[model samples]
Target: MAASRRLTQFALVMTVAAALAAAGCASGLGGGTYQRTEARRTMTVQFGTVESVRPVLLEGTKTPVGAGAGAAVGGLAGSTIGHGRGAAAGAILGAVAGGLAGAAIEEGVTRRQGVEITVRLEGGSYLAVVQEDEGEQFRPGERVRLLRDGGTTRVTR
Candidate 1:
């Protein structure tokens, strides 16, 4: 009975160890036997020059109008503070303050337009390039090179 009990305990321990080892192996802990892939891509890019620059106004912006209205209200309040000469001085000061506030509000709502470049790819596909600051310098109808990697992804030129 004693020998049989000892054998059973040993068997249980061995089974537990084997399970733990198998779990570790499956989780990529036993050895680094994982495959690595290279980052490869292919893309076509066209170059173009900046034709025009403009302000891209933000939508749903009420800053400028709100500022103007707020200014008017402030001016009216100031004008109320003084009689005659004081009222006139307050009105002038209020107008100046309102104009500055309105300008600031408008500036916040305005975004600078990016340069637009037009390019044609090999399959006659046209692409429009819009970039901030520096854009690809290619003239209209100028020949440009397009590069593609294995996966045929487009990269910036």
Candidate 2:
């Protein structure tokens, strides 16, 4: 009877973990992508030539979702480990471990390969922009346009 109960709890925990993993996968950070709020907003256009392009990594979004999901799953799984006080201790430890693991997993899953583009504007000032790689390669001396919307900017052909 106890074994059967433990098995069921383990399965439930696994199901939750799978769902959380799927939820962590988000949209791209490419140059072409924009947030919903950015639509229809006017952007300042600046012409420039690419001075250099370097590879980079864009970090993932840090939210409470991952940690919360992990904690719930871990607590449930750990509660099955022992009875009474032992189970309580296990649950606490498991939640801590799960929260850290979930955060790391979320970050690794959302991490993207990006590029740092150095551009020399027509006004003679130099600027560097980093954006997720969207198969649009920028080479040194290539002409491009910089679109600035407040604090945000994007480079395009």
Candidate 3:
């Protein structure tokens, strides 16, 4: 019975880890989204001088992937604590705790901090945009380009 229970626990852990691994891989951890289409669209490019740079945080969304994966792993972990009724109770409690932790962990992992750049266009228009920092820093008086395609715009240096 003990051996059988241990085997079950191992299987549960492996399954949970495999499932969560896929979710983790699919997660937008780098913090950017881009839509691609085969149709060619005219892109509008404009040059501007940066006026100011301010730090900003891009919040991450909550998803069931984290909670579900966590609960499964936690339940298996908890089941090992005791036998019979005690084990059953442990698994239940563990699942609840694990789910919460997993969600919080996912949010933290996906959250990203970037800079919001304010720029003055040549036509005397002011535009503020946020772009992911690729280890590059932006400051006042920096020359940048705004590329607009369809309804999306990206500020690049």
Q: Name the 10 consecutive residues with the lowest summed lDDT in model 1.
A: 26-35
Candidate 3 residue lDDT tens string, 1-157:
7897788778777766765575555432221344446146787889999899888887655788878877887788787778899999999998998888877776776677767889999999999887655556777999988887756666777
TM-score of each: 0.31, 0.87, 0.76
Better of 1 and 2 by lDDT: 2
Q: How far is 56's C-alpha from truth in model 1 (Å)?
A: 11
Q: Which parts of model 1 are misplaced by more than 4 Å?
A: 1-67, 110-120, 123-128, 131-157
Which pairs of residues clash in candidate 3, taking residues 3 or more apart in a chain or in different chains? none
Candidate 2: C-alpha lDDT: 0.83
Q: Report the poorest 10 consecutive residues by lDDT, candidate 3.
A: 26-35
**Candidates arranged by TM-score, highest first:** 2, 3, 1
After TM-score superposition, the amount by which residue 63's alpha carbon in candidate 1 deviates from its true location, in angstroms, is 10
> Model 2 clash tally?
0
Model 3 stretches with alpha carbons more than 4 Å out: 1-41
Per-residue lDDT, model 3, residue 46, is 95
Pairwise lDDT winner, candidates 2 and 3: 2
- Specify the highest-TM-score model's number: 2
- TM-score between model 2 and native: 0.87
